[model samples]
Target: MFEKLKDLKTYEAGKPIELVVREFGIEPKDIIKLASNENPYGPPPKAIEKVKNLASEMHRYPDDSFFELKEGLSSKFNISASNIIIGAGSDQILEFAVHAISPKKVLMAGITFAMYEIYSKQVGAQILKTESVTHNLEEFYEIYKEQKPEIIFLCVPNNPLGECVDAKEVFDFIEKIDENTLVVVDGAYQEFAAHKDKNKEIKPEDILKYKNVLYTGTFSKAYGLGGMRVGYGIANEYIIENLHKLRPPFNITTLSLAAAIEALKDEEFVKNSIIKNFEEMEKYVSFAKENNLKYIDSYTNFIVLYIKNSTQIAENLLKKGIIVRNMASYGFEALRITIGTPEQNDKLLNTLKGMIS
Candidate 1:
């Protein structure tokens, strides 16, 4: 057994509704869970129906090919279905990328997704992180040239901070990297980020034009399918073919496949969710400004607030049946809040204001 396996820090997920209810004695209905950035509006209505309709199929094995899911994604992204690689979630794709590239050294922004580091260490890769609240392209260029890590993971609208590097900047960076280097853009929050600037939105099609670049996104956030765990990676057919050799057969459930098919059909739901999220995000920014709290301007569904005593605030919010992410795990005290419905947002705003004041 690998010696470091004993010390491996398992990924920590946001607190769920039931967990909070059990711990705080809060009623399920009263608990407002904005910690995970799941769409409160729920999956497209058609997807819910699709899941229920396929419930009886649990006795049957999932379709190993995932034909319909790939078709759905291909239609949405306007790419050949042959180029899509489905995984349990974007997380699984990240793992596959690390193992596939077999990088001696991995490079990433210091404060991007935590899983990149965890997976890198799990495979015993030397990881190099360029320190920044947001990615410093100049710093990244220097490190990329010096280290020449085989895999570089870039998460657009980065998780904790909800900030992003411009598409042009990222593309320009990728162009400079050695062709041997695999550049994986984790766009799990792309839908929300797209709302910030339509003209400057990160397009998988645009990014995948580069042979070395692959884009991974999820149905978890805007599609309200986190529980279903459907995510995909888009690249050239060559990368998809090579990745399939490592992909687990029948990895996604039948219900998730059915639901994702329907979810993609209902583009209106995704559009509405983005619209609502933008409205709520603006409210969060305004409230933070009004309270004089320092916050990272978010292009994604979540916002990061710099709070010295973040854990204390989280404890107070949890007591009120409101849950948030505390950034102590990231070594800086801050709070990352997911945008919820207006009433839920109001509750959080009021509670946070009370505590901060």
Candidate 2:
């Protein structure tokens, strides 16, 4: 019943606030968690209100079709309902994409998101990862030409490193890839990337014209619904149909769906979140420069610092009731620090300065 399951590796999630409390004997309120890249603010106040109002309805299963959430997504993205598929999170959609494509071979950036590899393995696909922290489009193109893999997962504003690929470059890559190859553009950080753009904005819809591209997004980050696990994917109707075939019925809970629908109506919350993010990001970048420490310029909520003793730096902060991701699993000696509120950011900078200097 469980053949090949032993070879699979467990995902190492960021330590929870409660876990840190247990480990370090710290109060939750005093701890600043810039670890999981969760929205520092949290779900829109209206969404919380909506959840509270719906608390009595938990006995009912979520609407099997997810009509309300899909409708909200359709109005927001200007996509047809047929093209969207809801999942517990983008991670679930990643698994659905692998199953839908049923790939014999898969290709992804070596240092992008970790789940791509884990999900790819579940489907028993031959996985080829790139040899760089940031994906080289030229290298990806060459690899596509040589291996002709059946599926590819590209994380925009790639996790850990926080570097993003331009949409034009991605579309060009899509044009050159074999039509049979399915390309999943993981856009969990797409909102932050859009705010950073100068002359042009790259919408997820821009790539939808390509029959081969499936763009996945999540409300977990900016919408502050990480605990709710609300994420959706946009692709051609046929692609989504195949995913629906494999997707279990009523996968999302009733309350989470309601929260997401309400969150969509609160665009101002997301707008304010973006505004705060960039301002805080500037503080982080300036701190890195002032200290003469190298950090990857980020297009997303978090930035990666190249500290010499990353683990020690993180430990020092942990002692001071701060938690940041020590990114050793992605094979980098770095700490991926999420930009938090002004005070939180300042605390992080001061703590790091004390530890490193």
| Cα misplacement distance, residue 192 of candidate 2 (Å) | 0.5
Q: lDDT for every model? A: 0.87, 0.86
What lDDT is reached at residue 121 by model 2?
79
lDDT of 1: 0.87
Q: Write the per-residue lDDT of candidate 2 for residues 66-148, one digit (tens) a residue.
A: 99888889888888888999999988999888877768788888788888878877888788877766878888877888999
All candidates: TM-score: 0.97, 0.97
Residue pairs whose backbone atoms clash in candidate 1: none
Query: How many clashing pairs in candidate 1?
Result: 0
CA RMSD of each candidate after superposition: 1.3, 1.4
What's model 1's lDDT at 147?
Answer: 91
The true-versus-predicted C-alpha distance at residue 50 of model 2, in Å, is 0.2
